[model samples]
Target: MLSFNSVSSRVLQTLNSTFNFTATRHACKITSIHAITSMKTQPNQVNHSVELGNRRKCLLDRPGLFGIKRGMITWFNDNGRQFPATVIEIDSVEVIKHKTEQEFGYTSVMVGAVDKLKNVNNLKLFEQAGVSPKHKLGEFRVRSETGLVPVGAELKADMFAVGQMVDIKGITKGKGFAGVMKRHGFKGLAATHGVSKAHRKQGATGGNQDPGRVLPGKKMAGRMGGRSSTEMNLEVLHADGDAGILVVKGCIPGPNKAYVKITDSVKLYGKSIESIERD
Candidate 1:
C-alpha cells in the first residue's frame, strides 16, 4: 500500500510533466482556475474535471461552516472512475452583510466572491452589501449560538484541514427539456409491438376521478438539471492556505468553474462553531 506522501509525490509529478506546472506538496500552486488546465490557457473552454477514488477512512471533527464559494478542479485520480474529486479554488470570499437576530429576525452573514464586475447595477448591490464590486453573493446562518464573522472579513481556505468532511453545494449542469424517463427515472412504456409514440412517456396521469384531474405533483418531466445540488461528507484530501486550493475525496456537482457553496457537513456533525481556528 502506498503512503500519503507517495501518492502526493507521484500525482504531483505526473501532473507537472503533463501540465508543465511547478507544483509541490506544500507549494502546489495553480494559476488557472479551470479544471485540468493546460500549460498555457487554452482558447476554447472545456469542462475538465477531477476524478476521485476510494481512500482509507479516518474520523475527524467538523470545521466551522463557511459561506458560499466558487471553485474548480485541477487534477484527477482516474480519467473518471469511482470517486471524482474537485480542487476548489479559494477566490477570496469576503463578508458583505450580517443579519443579527435583533436587527432582523435571524442571524446570518452575507458573503460575496472577489469583486470582478464593473457594471453599475452590480456595484450598487455590492455597495448595499458593504463590499466592493463582486460578481456573486451568498448567505450563511450559524447552526448554534456562536461568534459571527464581522462584515468585510475575508474567508480563507485553511479554515478546513486535511481529512475533514465537508458539504459542497452547487448548481448541476443544465440538461434542459427532458422526458420523464431521464428526469424522474420512470420506466418507459413497452418498446416493442403496439408501442407507437409512447416509448419514453409517463403513462396514466389520472385513472378515476374520486378527487378529479391530474394531481398537482404527478411524475412528469419538462426541465432537468440546472438546479441546486449538494454532495455531503466529501473528505478533504489536501488543503493549502498559501495557494488557496482544496482537493476533496469525491465528486461535486456542476460544470467546471461553477460557483459552489461549501460548509461543514450537516449530515456528519450538526454542531456549533466552537473549535474554529481563526487567523
Candidate 2:
C-alpha cells in the first residue's frame, strides 16, 4: 500500500503534466513539478513578482535629453490595464558646454541632439566641445555644479526610468488669428436673440468711461498657440536606451516630429512613486 503523501505527489505530477498552465498561472500557484516535489525551492521562483527598482531618485537637478515627438501609442500594464502614452525619439545627444555659476551666474549644462551633416555654421562650437554638429541645442539648469555632466558625454533615454515623472517643454501648434471662442473658450453671444453677425464675438470690451481703454490684458482674439508651453508631472511609461525611445503618459505640446525639451519634474524632482515594466 502506497503512503498518502506519495499518492498525492504522484497525482499532482500527473495533473501538472496533463494540463497546460500559463507562466503567470504557474507562478501564481504551485504547478511546477520541482516546486511541488522539492521543499527547498525558492519562494520567488514559485511566486514570481516583479519589483520596481528605486533608482530614479536624485538629490539635485541633472541635464535632460532633447527628443522629437514620434506620436502616441497604447500601453498595457502587468494587470492588463491600458494607458495612453506619447512616444518621443531621442537622438544622439551630447554635452556641448558647461555653464558655471562663476562664469554665467548660474550652473547649467548645454546639450545638443540630432546630428547635422552639413550647413553647420558654428563648426568651431562643436570643435571646441569635441562633439558633432547637432541640429538642436538645449540648456538645462541645475542646483549646483555637481549636476553638470562632462562635455561630450552622450546622453541616452535610460537617464530616465519607467514611473519617473518628467516635465516636457514644446512649442504648441500655431493657430493664426483665432477667435475668442476658440482661443479663450469664451461663451460668445447667443445665436438667436437678435444678435446678427456677432454670434461669435467676444461680447464686450470694457466699462463705459471708467478705467477703460480696453484693459491691457483682456481676453480678446489674437494669434493662438505657437508659443512655448510646459507639461509637468507627466509619468514616464517606457524608456529604451538601446532604441533611443522615451515614452511618457498623455499628450504633449506641438505636432508630430516637433522637437521638445525633457527634464525631471520641477515639482517632483527625480523621485518616482512607482515603476512599470515594458511589455
Clash count list over all predictions: 3, 0
Task: Write down the TM-score for model 1.
Answer: 0.64
| Positional deviation of residue 108's Cα in model 1 after best superposition, in angstroms | 1.0
**Lowest summed lDDT over 10 consecutive residues: which window, candidate 1?**
50-59
Residue 103 C-alpha lDDT in model 1: 69
**Model 2: residues >4 Å from true position, as ranges?**
1-60, 270-279
Q: lDDT tens string, model 1, 1-279?
A: 989999988988897887666775468665566676469765874434211100112212322333333444545444644555667777767777766666664456777775675554556566665667666677776532254677677777888877888888889999999999899999999989899988988888885866667878887888899999999998888777667777887678887777788877776665333333221
lDDT by residue for model 2 over 112-211, one digit each (tens)? Answer: 9999999897899899999999999879877667789999999999999899899999999998999999999999999897999999998769888886
Global lDDT of each candidate: 0.68, 0.83
Measured over all alpha carbons after superposition, the RMSD of each candidate to the real structure, in angstroms, is: 29.6, 22.6
Scored by lDDT, the top model is: 2
